[model samples]
Each structure stands twice: as structure tokens, then as C-alpha cells.
Target: MVEPVADQVLRAIDQVRERYYRLIVIVGPAGSGKTSALQAVSALTSAPMINVNLELSRRLLNLTERQRAIHLPRILGDIVQETAAELVLLDNIELLFDVHLHVDPLRLLQRLARNRTVVATWNGTVGPNGLTYAVPGHPEYRRYPTGDLVIVEAKP
Candidate 1:
């Protein structure tokens, strides 16, 4: 039987466990099966998988720029603790692409990965330019660094 590509990605993730490269960003176009990959991996893993929906996270709390920078990690940390999960799958991360939000999500996720492995779905394509969160000229146009990030491209 042929293993699905997500299994391959999961194997890579598992291989990197306990290593310095703990955070992975799966970048792909819409409907490219990134979320499905995460779900499948979550189901088969021994460690609990905490799926953090950025949309719900945004609605559940309101914070100032300073407060968000300080508290977002704490809030996510609480969930990780409650779920007893060493691996976290972040979905709907495009919500953070809103330009009005002052928090740098890449930095925040990077910080969180220091404590636990994070695999997030990015709603864009990764290329030579980097991880383009938004098209150029858009208010949210920002290319976060790909350095130290284990990038996986999800196939449809």
C-alpha cells in the first residue's frame, strides 16, 4: 500500500523530535490538504495533538498590541498544558495575516516552539522570496523568515 504524503511529513516531523528543529510550517494553496494531513497525523500520534484555530482564538479574547504580545503565548501554553500535548497543530493561521494585528505571528510561534513542537498551516506558497503571507502592496504583505523552519509543502 502506498503511504500518503502526510505520513511522509509526519515521519519527518517525528524524526526531528528532540532536535533543535522542532517547528514546521506546511505551506500550500487553498484546499491542498494541509489540514487533513495534520488531522491524520494527530490521530496516529501517541502525543496529544492540540489543534489551535486562529479564528476562534481571536474571537475568544480581545487584547491590546502589548497585551497580545505578552498573553498569546500564555494562552496557548495553557491549552498545551491542559491537553498534555507536546505537538501542536495550528490551523486557520491566515487570521493572523490581518494587518491591523500588530503581533508578529512568526516570532510568536517561534517562541512557542521553544517549548513544544509546532506544525502550522500557512495559506500561501513558499518560494525563493520566503513565506509570503500576503501579496505585495497589500497591507498584510510580509515575508516571514524561513530560516530554522522545517518547511513542508502539502500536495493536493
Candidate 2:
């Protein structure tokens, strides 16, 4: 029997908490229900959900490299820090893929993980190879190391 996607995500969340890990990336192609799974997990866990809207984050994205270097971390850092829950649900993280911005999202998430677990929805695919970012051949594609990451592939 096939396990429900939410169950799979919940299992991964459990592992992250049990192992004291930081990040659980739910990867899948668009229309694969990644966001829905995140919502369901949030309901079950009662974790505060933060949705990173690209349009809203544009202000930070537009900052000069020098300014962003100093403030971007502070901005994203605040979201993770403000949530007291042990596990935070992060959705619409595609904003971090903007090549124009100098945000090292995965690194930021990992840093936050030191305090709590982060379950984020990633618009991509995870396979035997690795996580491939949204855009094909994009610079962010296949850039993250998967060894420490707990990746749950969202099934349609």
C-alpha cells in the first residue's frame, strides 16, 4: 500500500526532530502538490507557517550587494527566530532562487536549524542524483549537497 504524502512528510519531520537536524526539503515538480502537503503538515503539527512571497521579498532582493550582505540574513533570520515552534513550515521558498539576490537560502535555513527544525517546500525534484532547482540549467540547480538534507519527494 502507498503511504499518503502527508504521512511521508510527517515521517521526515519526525526524523529531523529526532536527529536534531535542521532542514527537511519537500521537492517535486510544479502541480505535484508540494504546497498542499506542507499545509497539511502544518495543520497536524500546529507549527507556524511562513510563506516567502517573492514580490514581498523583492525589497530585500533589490538591495545592493553590500547592503543585502548586511541585512538579508537579518530579514530571513527574523522569520525563523520569531517562530517558537520546534518545527516551522516554510512555503513559497522559490524566491530564494532569484539569481539576482545573494541569499544563500539553504545555508540560512541550516543556520536556523541549529535552534529548530525547518520543513520547507521546494519547487523541484529529488532523485538518486540530487535536488534540482526549479529552472532547468539554472545556476541554483543541483547546487545543494544532499548528504545532510532530509529530502521528501512529493508524489502527485
Candidate 3:
């Protein structure tokens, strides 16, 4: 039988405890139950769950485009720090891929995971090329090698 996504994520979190960046990406297309799986994991572990888009948007509401690009990294760091949880679950991370943000989404996640475990929902797919967000030619499209990051596929 297939393992549950939440269970897989929990296992991945435990597995990456010794890594420099404790990040486990749950990759799947929209409506693929990524959020549900995150919610499940949060409930199971009593970890805090964050809706990235909602939280980041609220924090960036007053910043100009240039200021946003300059301050985004620090702002994101503050957000994660505010959670005060050793393990943080993040969903709706589409904002990090915004071209205007001038951020490398995957790298940003890795940075956040450096201090604590991060299990985030990625609206994308994984394949031979690596992890992908959106299609090529799309403004938000991004791809990255898996590297040391652990991935849990959220199959529909």
C-alpha cells in the first residue's frame, strides 16, 4: 500500500534532522491535496501551519516594488521566526515565485529551513529535470535541482 503524504512528510522531517537545511517539499499540482496533507501533518505533530501568500501579502502590503525586492528576505525570515516552532508547515507558497519579488523560491525555502524544519506545499511537479513550478514561458515558472532537499509527492 502507498504511504500517506502526511506520514511520508513526517518521515522525511525525521530523516532530515541532521541536514543543514531541514526542508521537505510536498510537490503536486493544484487541487492535489497538498494543503490537506499539510493540515494533517500539522494536526498530527502540533506544528504551526502558515499560509504563505496570505501572511506575506499582509506584510508586504505597504512596500513599493523596489522596497519589496530589497526587504523580502528579511521579512520572510521574520515570518518564520515569529512562528517559534521547530517545525513549520507552509502552504500557498505561490507568492515566493512572483517575478516581482526577485527571490529564488527554492533557495529562500532552504534558507528558512536552515534554522528549523520546513515542510512546504509546492504547486508543481518533479521529473528528470528536477522540481518545476508552472510551465515554461510562464512568468512564474521556475525549476531547480533537487540537491539535498527531500521531496514528498502529493499524488491526487
Best by TM-score: 3
Clashing pairs in 3: none
Q: How far in Å is the alpha carbon of 111 misplaced in model 3?
A: 0.5
Clashes (N, CA, C under 3 Å) per candidate: 0, 0, 0
lDDT of each: 0.72, 0.76, 0.93
Give the candidates in order of lDDT, highest first. Answer: 3, 2, 1
Candidate 3 C-alpha error for residue 39, in Å? 0.7
Encode model 1's per-residue lDDT on 46-123: one tens digit a residue.
555545665436534777766655665567657655765777777777655655556677876777677678788887
Find the 10 residues in a row with the least total lDDT in model 2: 53-62
Cα-based lDDT at residue 70, candidate 3 = 90
Q: Could you tell me how far off, in angstroms, the CA of residue 78 lies in candidate 2 after the best superposition?
A: 0.5
Model 2 spans with C-alpha error above 4 angstroms:
18-20, 54-65
What is the C-alpha lDDT profile of model 2 across 1-156, one tens digit per residue?
A: 977778898887777765655688888888888888888888888988888765337656677767765676677777677777778888888767666566777887677777788888888777666667755676765456688789888877
Question: What's the candidate order when arranged by decreasing TM-score?
Answer: 3, 2, 1
Q: Using alpha carbons, what is the TM-score of model 3?
A: 0.98
Q: Which residue runs does candidate 3 get wrong by more than 4 Å? A: none
What would you estimate as the lDDT of candidate 1? Answer: 0.72
Give the Cα error of residue 65 in candidate 3, in Å. Answer: 0.7
